[model samples]
Target: MTESFAAARLPVRLTINPRQRQPPSVDLLAWIHRQPEYRPVVRQAGGGGGRPGFSDAVIIAVLAQGLLPGLFNLLQSWVDQQRTEASIRIQTGDTEVELQVSGRTDSARLLAQATEALRAAREPGPDTARELGAGAAREPGADAVD
Candidate 1:
């Protein structure tokens, strides 16, 4: 119970949007909550009636290092099981990355892209550093699941 070596966690917003006539974010929230690991951390988009929390955003506390592979893995598995199209917008601070996912999603590739973007957010590259200074979120995806 010491703070000295405790890993710092940042709240990252994950917005799950069903691409077609799939299902609502509530259903997805239940699915994610069913996961033993994510059960405790996953929460509703809006809390105490906040202004911008009106969407399908689910917040997950993340460590600056080891970027929650389980969360991505769970997302890919959900996509496979549902056999539907969806998009997950992962955001922290002013940096963001959107990923289109579906049954045919290349899990590994998306994981790589997300990891790279998050790393950049944590330690921005030359270009990303400038973009951050300019207050722009990263746009590396149109990044479809098809």
Candidate 2:
């Protein structure tokens, strides 16, 4: 018998607006796909039945590996060079978070916050049920406040 299980998918949405006259190009798409953990699907503005001038382009990607600080740093640098206003939204299951990068925003700090958020999501918390059970076993009213 074979059992089917749903695979985890991490969706990352990137919106880029170029400062220059040129919109995002095929080379940029290729560069993103070259990254180890990224599988990118690029869509030009208004090309996928969307409104015109919404953005220069959008890249929706699935992250095959866990979040890495270096990846964010590299993206930040690229956006900085292009003078692009960029926003990245990461969604895993029901949790969604976004980061916006502009000329004045500090990328390192943004990366740190993202790392913390990811860590908190993935790490299990204390077992309150187990703790309560242990206390009850030791004394019937151990946890009761008098």
Candidate 3:
């Protein structure tokens, strides 16, 4: 089942919100596409939507050949570089999990928590929810990101 599941495509949406005070002057979407790892797996979904003072964009990518962890890390790094906020939401059927980070948030810790939560969600068992709770307790940085 895991093998078959791995072969299936996953749709991940990355919503980027540039800094509220000073929006980035660079082409963030183009920059994201230019990244070595992101070029093949991700693409801008549509034109950005938001009012003048609150600029925001969304990128929808089909993950046909990569681990979620790697993608998560790449996004975290990209957002960190831009000094902005982003939310990565992975939707599988009716279940959706999100990892959100602000400019001041710690990326590594939030990434870890989000990764573990997704893992637990995928492999649901008697102890899965408990495991997620335990994982959350262990990561102090988890509270800062969400």
Candidate 4:
């Protein structure tokens, strides 16, 4: 199953929220479109709870399964460059894997933890529920939300 699975095959949605008092002047959607690597993957801006245009949160379209890995990598790079405190949420079906990242975040750890969280999310077992339940906690780089 893992062999046949492609990043494009896993449907994904990414929401990026900056954890700062003052919103940055940068336009995430526009920034993404400028990147040749990310332009195709970015579907649109997400409104989240409020009007799509009004909210600071920029939500992209649901990702193709095969695109998950690449997008995540791109996001990691983006985080490193921006060095902003932010929350990244990946949602699919009923599972939502969230990461609270800042300039101080450990990139290697963030990737590892996000991968683990995703794995657990995909394969829920007796222990899986506890690992992925609401209020799930983690070290500095990433955070999981049930």
RMSD of each: 6.2, 14.1, 5.3, 5.1
Q: Provide TM-scores for the models.
A: 0.60, 0.51, 0.60, 0.65
Clash pairs (backbone) in predicted model 2: none
Question: Which wins on TM-score, candidate 1 or candidate 4?
Answer: 4
Worst 10 residues of 2 by lDDT: 1-10
Give the per-residue lDDT digits (tens) of candidate 2, residues 7-92. 22344344433333356443445555556555434433354432354454555554422343445555666666666656565554
Arrange candidates by lDDT, descending: 4, 1, 3, 2
Q: What is the lDDT of candidate 3?
A: 0.57
Q: Provide the lDDT at 95 for model 1.
A: 67
lDDT of 3 at 68: 55
Winner of 2 and 3 under TM-score: 3
Model 3 over residues 22-71: C-alpha lDDT tens digits?
A: 66655556766766767776666567775465465566665542355556
**What TM-score does model 2 achieve against the real structure?**
0.51
Error of 1 at 75 (Å): 1.4
Tell me how candidate 1 scores on lDDT. Answer: 0.57
